[model samples]
Every structure is written in C-alpha cells, then in structure tokens.
Target chain A: MSETIMLLCAIAGTYLWRALGVAFSARIEPDGALFRWVSCVSYAMLAALISRMTVLPLGSLAETPMSFRLGAMAVAIAVFLLARRGMFSGVIAGVGTFIALVAFA
Target chain B: MGQPNHPPGGRMTARAVVRLGLRRGVGLPSVIVMTSMMGFGSLAADGGISFLTALSASALVWGLPGQVAMAELWAAGANLLTVVLAASLANARFMPMAMSLFPLMRGGTRHRGAPYLLVQLLSVNTWAACQEIFPAIPLHLRVVYYTAFASTILVAGQIGTGLGFFAVAFLPKPVTLGLIFLNPCYFALLFAGTRVRPYVAALLLGAFFGPIIYALAPEWSLLLTGFVAGSAAFFFFDVRPTSVSNAESK
Candidate 1:
C-alpha cells in the first residue's frame, strides 16, 4: 500500500519538473540564472548521492573494503579522462578494478 | 548555433530517422542506460525491493539518481516524504534538460501533443545526442526523430532492468556486487564530462559537502548540500561573467 503511494509520488515529483519545463520553455533560458541554479542544485544532489553510496553504502557494496572502493574510483576517473570521456569506459574500469582488487589482494 | 551535418532540403524519412536514432543510441547512450538500470535492479534485489516496485521505477521514474535514492531511502526506513523529496531533488535536473531541448525541437510549443508523456522519453543522453544532430534534421521530422530515439532508449532501459532483476539468481556474487558500482561510476563520469563551469563548481562543492553533511545529519544531507553547494556554484558563475563569455566565445 505504502509502496504504491511512494511510487506515485516519485513519478509525480519527477514529471512535475519536466512538465514545468514544457510550460515555461519559451521563457526559460537553459543557461539563465534560474536554470543555472536548478542545474547546480541537481548536480549537487547527484554528487551527494554518489558519494554517499560509495562511502556509506547499505548492502553488499558495504562488504567490500574501502581501499578497493577508493581504488576503483581512482581507476575509473583515470579511464574516464583517458577514454574520451566515456561513461561506460569509466564504469567498466572502476568495476574491473574493484573486482580485481577483491580477487588478487 | 552548430551547423547541421545535412542540408535542410534533405528530407529525413521517419524510417531513416528511426534507424539513425536507434543506431546512434546503440553505443554509449544505451550502454549507460542499460548498465545503470542493471545496477538499480541488482541494488533493488539486494535491498529486497519487489520486482514490481523496482521495475515500475525503471519504467516510470526513469531517472537513475531518483530511483536509487528512493530505493536507498526506503531501505533506510525513511518516511514517504523523505523518499519523495530525495528522489525529486535527484531528478530536478530534468527541468533544465527539457528547457534546453524543447526550444531546439522545432516549435517546442508547450503542452503540444501531450508533452508530459513525451518528456518521459527524454533521457539525458537522448537530449544530448539530439541537440548535436537535430539541427541537421528538417523541422517537420524533428519530433519523429526525437520520439523514435527516446522510445528506443526507453525499450533498452526497460529490458536492462528486467535482466538485472533476474540475473541475481544466475550471476555470481562478485558480479552482482560489481554492478552496483556501475551507476555511481557512470554518474561521476557524466559529471566529469560536463565542461560547463557552473556544473563543475556544483559538482566539486557537492562532493565536498556530501560526506561532511552525511556525518552531521544523514537525512538532511542531500537537501542541505544541494541547496548550499548549488547556490554557491550559481554565484560562482554569476561572479565570473568575463571568463564565462571568454569560454563561450571560444
């Protein structure tokens, strides 16, 4: 029962912003002040979420050592930088590093 | 504005455009969507989230950060309000994304043809790739091209989530564990890929604040960090107009 409501709420919240965008499309500038601020907020939110998941995960991920996790992040960033900014390249590199560290060390 | 790769008179057929949209969507865009959804599926399984709940999120919510936040917060026993707020905050970037892409897509007339539903297909990658190529497309075909592209990505995304949900049974523990890292790694990569100064500033500040605030108050961390860091980045952009214009000109 509660799960259903939460799902609806989540969907509504996400669509609200998008619908608002459509409504105000003509007036809004992508790089304008409000957009920029909103962009910043969303980026910040995502960054915070990513860091939280890595540093303070709740499940199987928490079983892995911090060193392995941190090492994976470093390798991933390096690959991302070197591989023409590809997301899959970075993620694959990170996951591979994590698995390798766990297996070898 | 960037010049179109093809001339205006060159009519892009719906079939040809759909083929083109699918082909371009095949590589990084689909991979990112598939892998991220896969990670979400695995995470959902680990958290003991129901198949229906997780799949609904993939099909409906679509935004990974929001889906992940909802799952994590729910697992942490957060109330409905917290879950919604966190999820919404994570997905709020869609506004700017839609704003930028709408004007670029032919008329961009608001509420035209049930845009609310159409925007559901507007994954970040679809928007990015479309911006680069849509200008080359004839105005009449722009909507067809975007719809085809977005829907194709959506299909791949849904399939990926379903696979992830079931893969848990056959997949190795190490593989399952590794999948969870894919979403964050990709998200971080996406952040790094953005050269825009405000995004960079917000990212750095957000990274700095995430852990600090988590230690202080886990529940409020996302909201507080986002508001403070994002506002700070906005100010950073505002204060550095000269450099911004220089970068813009270049």
Candidate 2:
C-alpha cells in the first residue's frame, strides 16, 4: 500500500540524518560552523512548519477561525513566559484556551 | 531514602542500571512525551489516518515534528517525495543531536553496530536527558542506560498514540481539536523558551517568512523559508567571531 511506502520513506528520511550523525560523529564538531548552520536551518524549518500549521493549516484545524488559533497561541506564549518557561503549563494553557473558545465561541 | 543495593563496590550492576533507566523513563520525561504523542494521535485521527498507521509513525518516525509533518502532508494528499522531504527537514535536528550525544555514548563501547540500533531510539527527550545524565553514568553503562530509557519512552509514546487515536470517538469535537492543537502550541513554546540568539532570530525570521512564502508556494514554503530565514539569522547573528563566543557563553 502507498501508506506503507510513505511510512517507509518517512522512516528512511528521518533515519538518514541520524545515521549521518552517527557516522560522522567523530569528525563533526558540535559547535563548529557547519553544526551551527545546520542547527539554525533546523530551527528555521521547524519555525516555518509551526507557523504554517498555525496560520494556514490543513485538515480539521483549518475549520477553526484564524483569530482563535492566534489567540490561543498568544495565551500559550504569555503563560509560558510567566511560568518561567514551564512548557507543560504553557501547552495546557494553550490547549485549554482553544478548547474553551471553540466550545463557547 | 534507603540506598539501592549494589555489588561490593558502589558501582551498579547492569541489571540495576537497566532498572534505573526504566524507572527514569516512567518519570516526568515519559509523561511529557506521552502527552505530546497523545496530541499527535489526535491530530492523525482528525486527518483520517488509521490508528495502526499513526502508531507506526510514532514507533518508526519517533520524532514528533517529523511525524506531525508527515501526517499533515499526507492528509493534504501531497506526493510521497514531498512528504518525505518535509518530514525529514522537520526532523533534521536529530542530526546535530545525535552528533553531539553519540560521542559521549561511544566512550566505552566497542560494538560499532550497537549505535545503529541505539540511535533509532534517540528522540529529543532521550537526547536531552542523556546530555545531562551521561557524565554521571559510567561510560560502559551509558549505552545500557540509554537503550533502556529510550525504549521505555518509545513504548510510552506508542501507548499515548493509541489512547489519543481512540479518544476521538468518545471526546467532543472541541476537545479533540484542542488535543490536535497541542503539537504546534508545544513547539512554539519550546522555541520561545530558547535563549540562543541565532536560534531565536531564526525562529522569528522563519515565522515571519513562513506565511508569506506559503501564500505564494505552499509546497516549497518550508524549504525556502528555512534557507532564507536560517541563512539570514546565521549570517547576522552567528557569523562574527565575537557574537559566536557571546552566544556560546550563554
């Protein structure tokens, strides 16, 4: 099935990076230019992914109003900073706010 | 608390280390991973993905970002290559993570093939834990502790995935949507929590560029945004020697 193939490709794609890391572990400098650049690239990619998901999502998430999604994110970030970077509380607050908004509004 | 029983020396036995690792796995780390995977499960379900497939993604992909990307792209009916590329890009952090952690893990190991299996279990949670815990563990036992710990969390993630997948049937639509939203929320918070300037710059620039580029080219937005924003951040915040040292000091 295509699902299985896609899963395999996903696995392979993910493993490719990990395998490269292991293979080049001895040679690669963790704080060197190459590593730092790669780290930045990954961070940027993740940021892009998250933003796209939040701003222009697919599937069920698109059903919600963009304002609601942005509001939830704002609440989550605010709580996260207020809690001194308590990720658990931040996530719960965000999800809770979204649920309340969706249920009530 | 009473001390754990050990051999004549203070060093723990292999079995004891394994037990400790398993116990650690069931602690706060597993809880966090479980909760996040639960969110992933709900998202997958909302996307009309089957439970088995979702569970397989958690088990095989193991990285949350990559798994989420795969699910989202697949649900949107993207081609296989695009899905693979997007997922891989999202999960590329694992490269630097593994590159850093593998050296510490390789200190007392002799078997080259062992890392291949052990690396498969390395997720963000495990890698972070190992970075903090490996120095205290005996080099010889590092691999064992890591394997046990990582495997336990992997199982926990699978359980969470299953729970989230089925909970959709009983949960209200709003609650399910909230659960699905947890993934992005968590990532955004995690990124915001970092103090690294280049990383922070990259996050902001990427976010700013993400929607704009996405409106123009949905398929290439992620890659293009990453290159443009990441390279900009890298050059602006990281290229200078003084700034590199300044960033590294923190």
Candidate 3:
C-alpha cells in the first residue's frame, strides 16, 4: 500500500542521518575542528527548533497567547539561572506559569 | 561478590547496571519524553491518523520533530516525497548527536552490532541523558546502561501516545496545551544550563535568527539558521583563538 511505502520512506530518510553518523564516527576525531563545528551547528539547530516551537507553534500550543508563551520562557530562564541551572525547577516553573495564565485567561 | 581480579566497587554485574539505568530512566527525562509524546499523540489524532499508525510512527521514527512533521504533512495531503523530506530535515540533529555519542559509547566493547541497535533507540532525551551519565558509568556497562535507559523511555513514549490518543477528548484544553509545551521549555532550560561559550553564542544567535528567517522561508529556516548562526559562533569563539595563536607563533 502507498501508506506503508510512505511510512518506510519516512523511516529510511530519518535513519539516513543516524546511519551516516555511525559510519563516519569511526573515522572522525571527537576533538577535531570538524567535530567542533558540527557540535555548534547541532546546538544552533536545536535552538532554532525550540524558538520556532515557542514563537510559532502548531496544534494545541498554538491556541495559547503569544505573551503567555514568551512569559513562560522568560520565567523558565530566570528560574534556571537563579536555581543554579537546575533543569527540573526551570521546567516546572515554566509549565506551571503557562498553565496558570491559560487557565485564568 | 568475591571475584579476585575485580576492583572493589568499581564494577557491577549486568543486572545491577540495568537496574540502575531503569531507575535513572524513570526520572525527569522520561517524564519529559512521555509528556511530549502525549502531545504528539494528540496532534496525530487531530491529523486523522489511526492510533496504530501514530504509535508505529513514534516507534519507527523515534524522533519527535520528524514524527510531528510527518503527521502534519500527511494531514495536509502532501506528496510522499515532501513528507519524507520534511521529516528527514527536521530529524537531522540526530547525525551530530550520534556522531558525538557513538565515540563515548565505543570504549570497552567489541560488539560490532550493538552500536547499530543502540543508535536506533537514540532520541533527544536519551542522547542528552547519556551525555550527562556516561562518564560515571563503567565502559563495559555503558552499552547496557544506554540500552536499558533508552528502551525505558521508548516504552514510556508509546504508553504516552496511547494515553494522549484516548484522553484528548476528555482532557481540558489548557492541560493538553501545557503538556505539549513542556518539551520546548525543557530544551530551552537544558541549553541555558550549558557553560560553553561557543555553544551559548550559537544558542542565542540561533534563537534570534529563527523566527525572522522562518517568516521569510518556513521550510528552510532551520537549516539556514544553523548555518549562519553556527558558523558565526564557530568563527568568533572557536576559530579566532586558534588563528590568533598561529599568528603569534609565526
């Protein structure tokens, strides 16, 4: 079926990068220039994705107001810094703030 | 308990290693995966995907961005090629992630096939957790620990997918929205906690460029933002020091 074929292609496309990483990792040095650049690129890419999800989200998240989303992120960052980079506290604060704002609004 | 050659408390049995991994997996990291996958399940349901198909995509793709892209594209009635391409692009972070992680996992093991299997289970949650935890783990047990940890989150994600699919009709909108928003918040906090200068610069530049470029070119925004911001950060923070040292030596 076409659906199954589509699914397979999706799987193959997604795995292509991981598989390539495995093949090239055997030859690549972790501390090399290439690795450093790649690491930067990966972090940048994750940042871009997170920003998009927060600023221009789809699905249920898109229903919330932009102020709430931005406020939640700001609060999370502040809490993370104040808590000495405790990941749990930051996440709990952000989610809690967003939920409270949305529920009240 | 009394092997003559074994160092005291320096090594553990495979069963004990796996138990430790399971315990670690059940913490905040797995909870993040579960809630995010719950969001994905709700999205898939809204997109008219069957429960089985959505769950299979979660398992097979095993990456939230790719799964979400695939679901959204399929829902929009896009062609097969477009769907595959979008999903692949969204999941491209796995390449660098695996490149970095595979080396850490390569020690004290001779098994050729284990990396292949472990790579399949790799996700953002598992990859991040492994980076934090692998240093404390013994080399021989690294593979087992990673396997147990990743598999636990994978199963948790599946359970979340099922719950979200069924609970969407009953749960309040704000609650579902909060569940969906957890991932971005968690990721932002994770990156904010990094102490590396180049990485921090990349994060800031990427965040600044993301929305602007997205408005201009939605499909290519991620790639473009990475290339521009990452290169700038690399040149300034990483390459400048080396070049200056070389000049001084000359």
Candidate 4:
C-alpha cells in the first residue's frame, strides 16, 4: 500500500512540470533562453534513454549476447541504407536478424 | 478536408473542439502513441507492476519513456530516489519541448491557470502534431484544440495501461514479446526518419557511442552517449554557414 502511494507521488511529481509549464505559458515563451536550455536538456535526456535501451537493455533482451546485438544492429543499418533510409525496413531487418540468430544458434 | 464550418466569430465550439480532437487524434500520430503505450503497459504488467501504478503513470506522466523507465527501475528493486532520477532524466527532454511552445503561447491568455493545463499535452506525439498543425489553426484555438486532442489520448492511455495490467495473462507470451520490442522499434524507426545531416549525425554517433560507452562503463552509458554524441552533432551543424546549411536543410 505504501509502495502504491509512493509510486503515485513519484508519477505526479514527474508530470508536475508539464502541467505547470502550460499553466504558466503566459509568462513563458518557448523561445526564451530558459526554454532553449530546457529543450537541450530534453533532447539530451531522450538520447540517453535510447542509448540505454540499445546498449544496456533489461529482462529478456539482456539474455541476448553482445555480439548478436551488435551484428543485428549492423544488419539493420545496412538494410536501412539499402532501402534508402526507410524506417520500417530498418526495424524489420534488425529485429528479424536478431530473432533468426537467436532461434537458429 | 476543407476547414470545418466555423461559428459566426470564425471559432470552433466546445463540441467542435472535442470532435476535431477525436478525429485528428485517430490518425497516424495518435496511432503511433497508442501502439507504443499499449506495448509499454503490457511490458510493465508482465514484469510485475500493479495495474494501478501502470495506469496511473500513463495518466500522470503521459510520457512513454519516463513511464517505462520508472516501471523497469521499480521492478529491478531500485529505491524511489533512483526511479525518480531516471524518470526525471528521461523527462528532462520535456524542458525543451515546453520552452519551444512557451514563446508561441505567451501572451494569448490572461488567465494564469491555462499554461499549467496546456503543459500536460506536451509529449512527443502532441508536440510533433502541434508543430505541424498549430500554424494552420486560428492562433486562439490552438491551445483548446490541442488540449482536447491530447486529453483524449491521455485518458485513453490511462485506461489502456490499466486494462493491460489486469489483462496481461490473457495476452499471449508472443504478444508480450512483440510489445517489449515495440518501444525500441518505434524509436529506431523514428530516428531513421530524420534526414537532416546533424540528426543523422546524432543517430550515427549515438549508435556508435552507445555500445562502446556501455562496455566501458555501463552505469553511465546513457548520459555519456547523449551528451557526447548530441553535442558533437549540435555543434557540427550549428556552426556551419547559412548557405551551406540551406543546401541540406529540410
């Protein structure tokens, strides 16, 4: 029960800024320097999450070896390039390669 | 479709706002968000988070990455502090999102309460859609329109997460596997959609630096890759001359 309450508090804390930002937009311009810094931090944070997923995944993905993961990424990149930067093909290629390798070997 | 018939003042009614939101939100952007959210919720439930927390996070955070990060950390038995830190880091990107819109929305409303409400709609899906659609709408309606559309999705996400949590057993293991993969797959695809030199540069640098940094220091890989790669890409693109930039700028 305490865990649930804590989780709720944390979730609310996380969203407080967004809710607060809009409420105060009359005073804040997205173009202000402070906003720019916020933008930078946001982009940086997004990059961090993406990197962590690719490099330090959890649960089932954690079981997949490093070599296989890297190799699958390479194949995905090659497919992406070959498809002239198509997003769907790149994903299919990467995921397909990973599954195939894992299933076969 | 041509612009919907407007009222005598050339404005949309409250009902119209809700209708437009439901319609526009059912399109590609909302689908992507819903797809990602469903996958995320399922993964959280399968991993042992209660349906309540998963649902509440979607309702509150409304940011998919942060919600996923929080769930993963909690499942891993990390303390509340670590979970918040990781979540805040994932959410730190919102600061930029909020900043970009603040300029556009600054003087439109005299009421002090509106900005706080508007901020809830500032996630990747809403921001990207608003950036595309706001210029087309009458300036005054942008906030109302976005609030309507975003609230629909937010409410949907909350409900979806709750349903996913309790219903995890009904969803097959293969489906859950697919859900776990969806989060990464979406980002990978979205990253590929960028054709800008700097964005492409950031993706490549991130891809290259990510694993390498992890091998060296797993605990700090996310911060290192983002700062190092993103800064390199930012400077490389930002410092170039305007004429050269115009050639590749999109």
Calculate DockQ per candidate and list them.
Answer: 0.54, 0.56, 0.59, 0.30
Say which prediction, candidate 1 or candidate 4, comes out ahead on DockQ. 1
Identify the candidate with maximal DockQ: 3
Model 1 stretches with alpha carbons more than 4 Å out? A24-26, A30-42, A86-88, B1-4, B7-17, B73-86, B99-103, B109-113, B127-145, B217-220, B238-250
Give lDDT per model, in order: 0.76, 0.80, 0.81, 0.63
TM-score (0 to 1) for chain A, all models? 0.69, 0.80, 0.85, 0.68
Note the B-chain TM-score for every model. Answer: 0.75, 0.72, 0.84, 0.75
* Model 3 per-residue lDDT at B195: 71
Candidate 1, CAPRI quality class derived from DockQ: medium
* Model 1: pairs clashing at backbone N, Cα or C within 3 Å: none
B1-250, model 3: which lDDT tens digit per residue?
Answer: 3222344237667787788778888888778888888988887887788898889888888988888888888888899999888888888777877876777666646777667767889887777777777666766777888888999999999988998888888878787788888888988887787778888888989998988898898777888888789888888987433554333210
What is the DockQ of the complex in model 1? 0.54
The fnat of each candidate, in order, is 0.67, 0.69, 0.69, 0.33
List candidate 4 stretches off by more than 4 Å: A16-44, A65-105, B3-21, B196-199, B206-228, B239-250
Query: Which candidate has the top score in lDDT?
Result: 3
- Interface RMSD of candidate number 2: 4.1
Write down the TM-score for model 4: 0.73
Q: After superposition, how far is residue B43 of candidate 2 from its true place, in Å?
A: 4.3
Model 2 spans with C-alpha error above 4 angstroms: B1-25, B43-49, B72-93, B96-108, B127-149, B239-250
Candidate 4, CAPRI quality class derived from DockQ = acceptable
Superposed by TM-score, candidate 3 places the C-alpha of residue B221 at a distance from the truth, in angstroms, of 2.7
